[model samples]
Target: MYINTVSHYLPSEVIGNEYFTNINNLSHEWIVERTGISERRKASAEENTSTMAIKAVESLLESIPYSKNEIDLIIGATYTPYDTIVTLAHAVQHQLQIPDIPVVSISSACSSLLNAIEIVEGYFALGKASKALVVVSDHNTAYYNEMDTVSGHLWGDGASALLISKERQTDSDMHIKKIITGGAATSGKAIEAVVLRPNDRGVIMPFGRDVFQNACVYMPKVSQQVLHACGLSIDDLDYLIPHQANHRISLNVINTLGIPVEKLISNIQYLGNTGCAGCAIALSENKEKFKKGENIVITVFGGGYSYGAMLITI
Candidate 1:
């Protein structure tokens, strides 16, 4: 599988650390020191996960120029879907007027993008799809309380779309080398540590310590496993893209892997943690910065106690 184009859409509303500081009674410097997020985007009232994803897909289609009839598969990844009855993938298909293509939705939290990529690759391998559109979006503001100092302040709303094809479209296109995904259920109790309950008072309550500890361990472990499977090492990686859950979590994973901080591609400072859209958006935003044939590793850990990694060649 090859990536033909990548694009993203972010809402107009920008929320800064100052907004959180005033609401949470904490200094802006304190928030920055802990999360390294200065600002994040929030979707407007009219925007939802599906709409954001459709906008991203439109941008991608503009670049790739693939007709609706050419697309064989559509995969949407999101944990914050606007409606459970109609999947985000189906909504995107409806908006794009994509004809009768199989639409699948994934709810793997932060790891959903990578997981979606793997699913598309499987379809390609089976000769089931020649062209695939993978879209991911999340509206964290919809679930979290604005006044909550911890989880609420850490999320942003964004969507990303990637055009993947069985054959490379151009010499500049990037190849999907290896994608590995897995997680341990031993930490199943940690599920409640980072949860967004419907009836609960608009708060995405998270146990800070538990999440931090698990992220620090699982992220590096899965990253190493994927790298080894691809017969690559940390030194061979030209760029490392980890799920932008928190600044500290990213730093810990880099430190544990002993990879240089400069090699890690991080957008948390501006985009915050956009859940499933984090890694995909970061990849799209940094696409031009990558050189051909360079190795890029994406490692992610999410709320299901889920973790995985993918190795790509640019």
Candidate 2:
């Protein structure tokens, strides 16, 4: 179970913190200090979750055009789907012209893609599916509250897709060294960390304190466990990518763990928070940073109040 190819699509609209000052009492400095967000990209009217999924899958297909028929499963991991009845998997399958493959949608928030990785790991191990496509996308601004300054400045619109494939003879061309991939919930935690109620027009309600605590405790611990499972240590990883929820959270985790700042792929400064697509987009956005044979650790705490971590040898 290895990631053979990857692609991502970001929205066209860019909104800076200044736009919020007029609507709320928050200033650019306050937002950056609290959540470490300067700007976030919002989806335009032309873009939907389906359209964004197609954009990423199109790029993914180009790199493996002849292998389309080999794919048997398509997983669309998104918290923001355009339609309830029609799964988002159909959008990628239809655009890519692969009608026979099973298409399904899953929503686990930021950890959805990592959970997808675990799903494919079993699919390959159990001889259920040879090849799978995992795509994570969301359009939060359409439903996000403008006044909820903490969360509003943190989320962005983006979609990322990855092709998981198996090697014919265990060649070095592709590799996936799965270290720990999933973790149980921390005790006494709420079922939902963040929620929005449209009926009352409430802000993107989130227990930021709880989210921050979860990331700090679970993320690094899982990262270490994954590395140990891989017969490696934290210092051995060349790149570490976490859910770009906030710069402060990322920095706090790595710094507290004493992992070098250069070894981390901190993208919260630019991408804001992309929910399930955040870590995937970071990997896609920084693929070049990974040298062949370099180890990487990806950890995420998603909206399910669920968390997952993985160690892969690139």
Candidate 3:
């Protein structure tokens, strides 16, 4: 599968670290030192996961001359959705006015984008679809609690869209070389380490030490698996894009892999942790920086003790 275009959308409202510092009674420098996030965008009342997804898809469609009818598959990835019954993929299809296409929603937390890519790759390999729209939209602000400083302050709202096709359509297209995903429930207690409850006071709670430790181990493991599957080593990677869950996690993964820090592509300092949209948003934002024939390795770990990696050629 080839990526024809990638587009991302961020809301107008920017929430700085000072907002969290004042609300949580923590020092601004402390938050930055721990998470390396300075600011993040929060969706306005009018924007939800679906709306932000549509905006991204529209932006991607506008850039490419492909007709909406050409898109036969629509995949939506998000853990934070306003409505559970009406999937974000269906909402995007409704907005785009596409008929009878398969609209699938994936909820694999931070690894959602990589999972979606694997699904689209299967569809294309099976001759089931020619054009696919993969969108990841998350609005964590809707469920965030001011009192919960652990995971609450790390989240932001945004969406990213990718247009994937069976064949390369442009000279700038990126090819998906390999995608590998796996999950390990270390223990029963690990299952509840990261969760967003269903109650009215739904707030994301993360066991910091468990998450950090697991991320440090699983991210590099999965990345090496994908790299080996593609017959490439860490030194062969032109860029390393890991899920922007935490700056510490990113640094740990880089150190574990022994990859140069300059080759790592990170925008978490400005965008915060956007759940499923983080890696895709980073990829879209840095699309122009990649040179032809260069290789990129993207690794991600999220809730459910899930982790995955993908190798792409630019």
Per-prediction TM-score: 0.96, 0.93, 0.97
Clashing pairs in 2: none
Q: Which 10-residue window of candidate 3 scores lowest in summed lDDT?
A: 183-192
RMSD versus native structure for model 1: 1.4
C-alpha local distance difference test of each model = 0.86, 0.77, 0.88
Q: What value of lDDT does candidate 2 attain over all alpha carbons? A: 0.77
| Model 1 steric clash pairs | 293-314
Return whichever of 1 and 2 wins on lDDT. Answer: 1
Which one wins on TM-score? 3
lDDT tens digits, residue span 35-147, model 3: 98999899999999999999998889878747878999999999999778899999989988999988899888788999998889888888989999999999988877766
Q: Is candidate 1 or candidate 2 better by TM-score?
A: 1
* Higher-scoring candidate on lDDT, 1 or 3: 3
